[model samples]
Target: MLIVITSEEFVEDEINIIKRLLKEGLTTLHVRKPFFSSEEMKRWLFNFHAEEHQQMMLHQHHFLAEDFQLKGIHLKEEHRKSIKGKEQDFLEKIKSQGWVLSTSFHELQEVENQTLFDYAFLSPVFTSISKHNYEGKKFSVQQNKRPVIALGGIKTENIEKAYQLGYQGVAVLGCVWHQENVITSFKNIKKEYKRVYQ
Candidate 1:
């Protein structure tokens, strides 16, 4: 799957771009607005069509996931660390509710050890395009047991390389949101991914 994550801070016309992305076949959209209050997040979510709501994964106010009928809930790396012991019960409840579970990882070992999540993100596979001085480590997914989506600095040019490295999917943030034409950038990345994977 080709996933697109929202920037931490909302960008201009982000909703429009996201709608267009869903219209253009973007299957997953991770809503990662850490600074947005639950009420603020609700108002922002209301901007989308009800049908579009299912395509999103919330990074905060997970209670909203069920309310919005969102696809899933995402745990930021820090959030995951904070709830170390309660993860099992949390995962069971979320899974029982049919919400897809996902989280982030900076290390390959963490990805391998976590099999309960439907998928997870392993980032910085390439030099980051949106975050300054955040270098890429090119983490390999060869040993991962669950689906591992490569994140950070993913672009059309290196998509094939990500596939070759054994990533089950790729999550694009900077490569799409930072562009002047988000839809066009998304299409290019999707095209490149299909060319390489299909």
Candidate 2:
């Protein structure tokens, strides 16, 4: 799966750009707008076709996931820590309801967890294109039992490398949202992913 993340800052014509991405086979879209209120998030989601909500993965206002029939919920590091004891009940309920649950990990060692999440993000596999000085972790992802999608600095050139490192998927943010032509960039990345894995 190729996941695309929303820019922290909403850009003009974002809906159009996302529409094109979905058309180009984006399996998931991570809506990680820390600054957006629940109402703002709702409004932003409404701008897309109602069916598009099925592909959305939310980072906040997780209540909105059920409310909007989103694909799943993503837990940021702090949010994941907050729900430490309740993780089981939360995962059980979400699983019963058929929601995908995922989280992020900065350290590869932390990825060895008991709870089964559908996927997790292990980032900075390459020097970041969007975040300056956030160099690549260069960690081999072979040990993850849970599906781990490579994140951070992922682009067409290195996406294949990530898959070779044993990542089940790749998440792209800076490469798509910060590019001069977002749609073309997405198409090219998707092409590269298929070339490497298919």
Among all candidates shown, the one with the greatest lDDT: 1
Give TM-scores for every candidate, taking all chains together and pairing residue i with residue i.
Answer: 0.95, 0.96
Q: How would you encode candidate 2's per-residue C-alpha lDDT over 1-198 as one tens digit per residue?
A: 889989998698888888878877887999999999999988888887767889999998998888889999998889877888888887788987789988988888877663557889887888888899999987787876778889988989898789889999899999988989999898899899999878
For model 1, what is the error of residue 129's alpha carbon versus the real structure, in angstroms, after optimal superposition?
A: 0.3
CA RMSD, predictions in order:
1.3, 1.2
Colliding pairs, model 1:
none
TM-score of structure candidate 1: 0.95
lDDT of 2 at 55: 92
Candidate 1, 31-142: lDDT as tens digits:
9898999999999999988789989999999999988899999988777878789978977899788899898888777788987678998878898998998788898888
Inter-residue clash pairs, candidate 2: none
Q: Where does candidate 1 have its weakest 10-residue lDDT segment?
A: 9-18
lDDT of 2 at 100: 90
